[model samples]
Target: MRRPWGLALLSLLAGVAAIAVALGPLLASSGGVHGFAFSTIGVGAILIGLNALRRNRRAPSAGVLATAVAGIGAGAIGSVAMLGMLVTSPGGPTLLPFAPAGPVVAGSTGQWAASTTQVTLTSVAVVGVGPTKQVVVGNGGSVRLAAGYSFRSATSNPQLDVRLERRVAGGGWTATGIEATVAPNAPLTAATPAYSTTLATEAVQYRFASGTSASAPVSVVYENQHLYTGMAATIYADAAPYCPNTAVEIAHLGGREAGDYAPGALLIRISTAVGVRANLTRASQRALALHECSHERQWLNYGGSQEGYAQMKAAAAADFTVGDNGAPPIEHAADCGAMALEPNGYLGYGGFCTRAELNEGARLLNGQEY
Candidate 1:
């Protein structure tokens, strides 16, 4: 009897549909490695079975049908593997979804550490940056960070004045300090300032005085910090750095918003500059992030809005010592909230809003009514 090849082809299509339905949740919960590997194997096996059926198009026999059946059975191998994984583990579906969460104490950097100022800054800033990365996990996690940087004088006749700097998640890069003893034709013993950061790695950057290098640093000797499991807000670098001196997203340009308020999700905003070098310090970039985090809390916790933020700031200033016209209420309240996250609540009290570089970046960093 001639084999009903059309019926077999339909079976292959049906099997694919069934696999998608059955494997979807498993693939999602399979935690990346096992899920991806086994899924590929399973789907690949089914495809192979279907292809074999197609090759013997002329006259099909019982032997050919048996081979097709065997191939199709191979696809079931994934379901078997997934079942094994579920049976082997005590907790059926627990996996490392993100960095772990746990208890944490904010850092006490004492007074603000000084850095080279590109522009006279203002009282605009970001607060509670360290905690953004130091998450509290239940099963434990690691935040890969770098402490110090090492460099070499790429120039043969090197007139090198090297400085080391670091920035954390979506914050500005700050100059740590100049290196010592970069002698003639020796190893890259010059030290750059040591700084730590997290994978919001978009904002995390290391600045070495290789102003004219064809390549930028893509990798770092990152150190990791173990953490417990839970969810928290984190800042990530924008796809493209902002146009020079433009803070956050250019709200005026089109439909994109710098930050937005929604349920459960926190929107932390940051400023980006492209070719136009922003005159900013690491501290200022951080301060800017803190200010944005405050906005996040405001949006998530409270309904963050222009009118609402303004009203709240006025209320807060009346209760607290919110300085003169130097820092606008919206910016000032953000700074205050940012400060509250510090070990010493007032560590960055006036750090961000009280600087000169606070001009365009400041007014626009968090979007002030000023």
Candidate 2:
């Protein structure tokens, strides 16, 4: 009995072709032009694949041409996915530097006052890059970690502590302990209580307490020798605003720093002045990016899609008495985008922007005065 090799091959090719069809939308959302092209080919492949399967059941050789086309489509999709990853990876393209950089080291001197100290970082370096891993911000001066995560275990316990953690491969950071309670108001020699917990860590977090004036500057030292890697630090703005008529490149932002106001979104760009800030942390930057892009999306979607509706919202939103009844609904949506994208709320970029922030984001998105 001869095995049905031809039928088996057809099944394999069909399965891969289906995958390309599914990945098409994801690719389009992630990269746009390149994605769209890949998606079109993928769709075409599915059609060819169906025909090939039909012919395969009749005469295997009859499906050869279709199978070849299907394979090309599958290859096209795979190539696009790889290209998108490379283009967005950190240190890839500057304009669309989508990948987050290394983790940010908060304590310059590894010392935080006996107050509330919280640092949300990206990762904990498991590999080696530098020697500035353990951050202990003490009184007088500050300690700084270059941009990665590396820690030394603590020897004893104290009253308060600034915990640290490492980043998980998926996303978000988690904490275990620092081997000792780090008293921010007591001496390094001071010991309060003995706490014990056996847990491994991935990401890092800083914890600070409030309502205490014991005059004990926190003394944090290294405990373990493990180093965290792939953490990204803050990235400052390189250029001004994206001059609408300009092109994009990797080495250059061709835009502004801090808050990237494409001089505000579409219509907002027309009515509102640019509102780019400086010194925004990565979290804030992500939030701002999400908010602004939401505007651009809505504008291209609703405004461009329906000029009459756009005119009505533009006119009604100006009547101070009525304000904006979701006019250019993009405003409300942009706020939501900011809330969703922001991780640490550094600069109010993430979850739940205040009323003021919502208004501002919405205003800019609506192309109104802010």
Candidate 3:
């Protein structure tokens, strides 16, 4: 029993060492473990300690005190040394260093932070599919973020710079106006002087060495008021660029036609880059045309009902109108009521208008005595 006790203690410590090695990478940023080689060696030391303990335990006549002391010494030294290297000098990691705050500036070019003009830089993001990474800095009351830096480094080039592109929601990531850079050797940190934007719901993701990443999307709020039919139409037109490939589909009454419905022309009352740039893919154009045609047929059979139904479907799918606007629940309900009664065209009276207009439209559509 006494002989085996020494082995048990050593084996336990060895297991602890191995665990530290495996967890080293995960805790690297926080613990400051720099090189993979060092981590592996640390793990091996733990294994050695474990094996020593096992050997002594199996030797019935072995000196229990000797075996226990040897195994414990090996494990203790290896574990302490591996952990100590993390926050030390030379190759020591640079993550949790303390620092002073600074100033911030904003411009069309981008938002920047610095103590002086020479060191100033804007918060920028370079996107990629791998691990997400980010840097957050405060500028006055505002905060700026730069994310999506690649983990791999360039040969000979010590300065690791990343590129980011500007694009709308649902659009392919592009490498246009967005860009950011950081020094690998520098301590990970936050700078002072922040910048703000109206797009609070937007998210910025950060990746480190291409694996699992983190995202911080913004938050915001606003109100939308009721508008006349024509006004609503105009607003849609003005916000065309924001809605890209989107257009108002009006249901047309079926004249003495044989088919249930005839497709309506895609209207472009307000010129949006999406509307003006005729480069819509064949499939996209076909889908849009077909959708509108469905509305026309529905209108002839029912009055003013198509938009409401479509909007309702959109809501169910969690697909909200993006970029330029949103749809209120009241308006959605009103539109649904209008479609139930007049399936053909926009009766222009049901959706989110004044209570009087809505009640009157609802009553007439329901065939109730007004």
Highest lDDT against the true fold, candidate: 1
Report the lDDT tens digits of candidate 1 across residue range 1-370. 2344544444455445446634454443343355445455556556766766775666666666666666577466554654554343221222211111211111112232122111111111111121122221111111121112122221112233334445655566666565423322221122223334343222344434334321122122222122211111112221112111112221232332223222122232333341124443444444444555554444322333334545555554543344354644554555554443331323233544334223422333243422
Q: lDDT of all predictions, in order shown?
A: 0.35, 0.33, 0.33
List where candidate 2 sits over 4 angstroms from the true fold: 1-64, 86-140, 147-370
State which candidate, 1 or 2, has the greater lDDT.
1
Distance from true location, Cα of 243 in model 2, Å: 43
Q: Estimate, for each residue in 129-207, the C-alpha lDDT of model 2 and write its tens digit.
A: 1122333211111121111221111111112343433333344434434322222221111111122112222222222
Worst 10 residues of 2 by lDDT: 231-240
Question: What does the lDDT read for residue 24 in candidate 3?
Answer: 47
Report the lDDT of model 3 for residue 310. Answer: 53
lDDT per residue as tens, model 3, 1-370 = 5546644565555645545654443333322334435555445545554555566545543455455555555556655655654433223322311211221111223232221112222222221111123222111121223332222111111222233333334564444333343434322222112223343223332221211222232211111212214422443332232222223422332342111212121122221332234343433333233323333322222322234335434542342112112544423333433443334433221233335434533443333322
Runs in model 3 deviating more than 4 A are 1-36, 50-147, 150-370
Better of 1 and 3 by lDDT: 1
Worst 10 residues of 1 by lDDT: 116-125
TM-scores, all candidates, are: 0.22, 0.20, 0.25
